[model samples]
Target: MKNLFFSREKIVQTFETLQGLIDGIRADGKIKNEEVIALKSWVKAHNYLEMRRPFNDIINIVKTAVSDHVLSEDEILDIKYVCKKFLDTYGGSKMGHLHGFASGIASDGELNEVEWKSLAKWIHTYDYLRGSWPYDEINALVHKHRSTLDLSSEEKEIIIYYFNDFCGLNKNSSLTHPLNEPNKPITGICAVCPDIEVYERTFCLTGESKKYSRDEITDKIFECGGIYKNDMSNLIDYLVVCSEGSPMWIYSCYGRKVEKAIAMRKAGHPIQIIHEFDLLDALEDAA
Candidate 1:
């Protein structure tokens, strides 16, 4: 029984990774050689899970598809089908299901009125997911569009961009189809142009920064009269996530600190997960 439990836990974790990889690969709408290598590497890394049902089937499909070092459109579709099947059968957790559902809704590269209504209903049904990193944010965005009789092209673009980021899709994805304007704020970021109060708020940093070193960031926080902690805690008012090299996970970025911050936020902690650029802007304003 203990071994069975352990195996199940491992399977869930691995399955989540597999799902992320698939989303990232398909994000651009075309699989590249590097992506094929990544898929092959993922299969090889998680070979132990092959003894299971969907994993076994998934592994076989990936192996066969990549064996020729070329991923035809049809082959990619087959892999996505299997992954979707696995998601339907064993959709690990509510969060996982939310991610999968959002991906499915945006699969056609557009979110129609029907799909938006369906997604809104799903979000409403999962009231327990409220206050969570994405659930609350997504809920707000959905209702915002639903109330409007007609959405502008930019508004529609916002919906697509938000989901693409949430689903771990590359910003450069064909689906994003960047508009000729200033960069849109990342929807996943808790605060867009936040009024940063550094005087007394506690801050925590996660991921690497391209502009500043760890010590420099901590120094800046101190200089701005903010407290900097290396770890996340309830005391943390602002969790400044470095934009550089931060990989997007299903709910948050790829870090335990991020996961903890999201969990804490869901539990009623007023923790704001801001981007490094936000911090820089705050520092500049203070100066």
Candidate 2:
């Protein structure tokens, strides 16, 4: 609390504030009526509506937790996860953890074993101080250094997080494969549809392939005068779904980019999602 740098103090203060809020409701491991009333009052007081949708989602989850009159352990974890996610996504400095831990010792107005364990667990589990993850920077760093060399499990986790969080790409989006070139090919035509030139037509690809390697597929796309992208956007003309029925395939497919594509289609965009075989057939026809 003393001799602290101004910025570090601010981050610590913010962390403690959040910790206090969460602690207030979960003090007895059950949410009481008074706690629910207090939470509602806090929600009504904060103008987080102008912020991201997740903030509102946090509010809603609090309401749901209170609706049951008992907050389950799973609900507490969910709340914690969302709060951690919000902090990770938006802001907080990693260096402020020491102060937060120090202050959090007395967060529940005591340095008891339970409070200590909670502080330790929270400190270890969440990167509370590491404010504002540079998702774009991390993603760019990964892509710039990406290679055909198989990624280790940790590396894969990093890339997957980038796709899931930063790029908003789905699990179906192939990260193991080298990313396709963003630029259009110099020249080529699909023999099956030579009239419909693929050049400058942005295409987002998803799912794993069986017959052809991802690189081969990307090469064929480039050879067919198409622009290959890793995600679906209004700029995308096609979505090449390679495989289906993966555990979370449905959820990942309906992610932000695909939903955006759907909306764009409704607005008269000419985007189409085709299977890998369809793509292969087009290439074979051109060949």
Candidate 3:
């Protein structure tokens, strides 16, 4: 009793799977289509072949599958916003492709401004790979929408094609960046470099912290511009040498200069030094 292409069942199922990926379920039910087929084999081989399918694929599938899923112009825009959050929390790949795909339909009047902007925002989130290859296909879809909408600065930012083919991301848009941006910088108020939020990194640092959640290990790395190699290796930027819950590794954050010095002294490293925070006088706001 759901609908045609997509049943009420499929819609519910789609969003649920998206949530599972976000929660790190580590199971097979979360995948669909060829991804499901390929994942079945991988799961049997390792029972832990974490999903790598692009999030854009899922949205496209859902859109095509739902027979009654006709979207109004505003609805198209709304869906695009949801797609960003879904992909951010759930993970994705080839975001620019999704944008180009949408642009083609919306530009040609097969879709509307809402759809065009939605696809554009998703694709625009890309820092690189915008308006390249398939993008021409997307661009050729409709110049009318491109010229007629008078999109806001933020909406326009999504399609500016800046940095050459690298034009993605509506610099003016306030939406959070997609998770797929490989070099997307971390944003938060962490005073010290945050640890990597990945499972492996969290596992490595968990048992040591009494008050910490396992998720915060890699989160610290994200805060501090650190790396996340799959397995534990010296490739790590810092050891985070722990002294009974006190961090042993000294971080060089913008404002923690004095604390670093004190920490060094406590660890018995010779020469008193100031914490980065204390040394940075001009950074009073940070203090």
Best by TM-score: 1
The per-prediction CA RMSD against the true structure, in angstroms, equals 11.5, 18.4, 19.2
Task: Kindly provide the TM-score of model 1 when superposed on the true structure, using C-alpha atoms.
Answer: 0.43
Better of 1 and 3 by lDDT: 1
Candidate 2: regions farther than 4 A off: 1-197, 244-249
**Candidate 2, 59-135: lDDT as tens digits:** 67766765665557787677677767656655654433333233223222223334434543454455332212221
Reference-based lDDT, residue 115, model 1: 65
**What's the TM-score of each model vs. the native?**
0.43, 0.30, 0.20
| Candidate scoring better on lDDT of 1 and 2 | 1
The true-versus-predicted C-alpha distance at residue 71 of model 2, in Å, is 48
Q: After superposition, how far is residue 278 of candidate 2 from its true place, in Å?
A: 0.7
lDDT of 3 by residue, 1-287 (tens): 22235444333434433332221111211222322222222224322212322334444433433324332334334445564566566454453334334322222212235544544454445525422333322332223245325444433333322211221212332222242132322121112322122223221221134444434544554444434333333332222322234322212222233233223332333322211222122123222
The clash tally of candidate 3 reads 31
Q: How would the candidate models be sorted by TM-score, starting from the highest?
A: 1, 2, 3
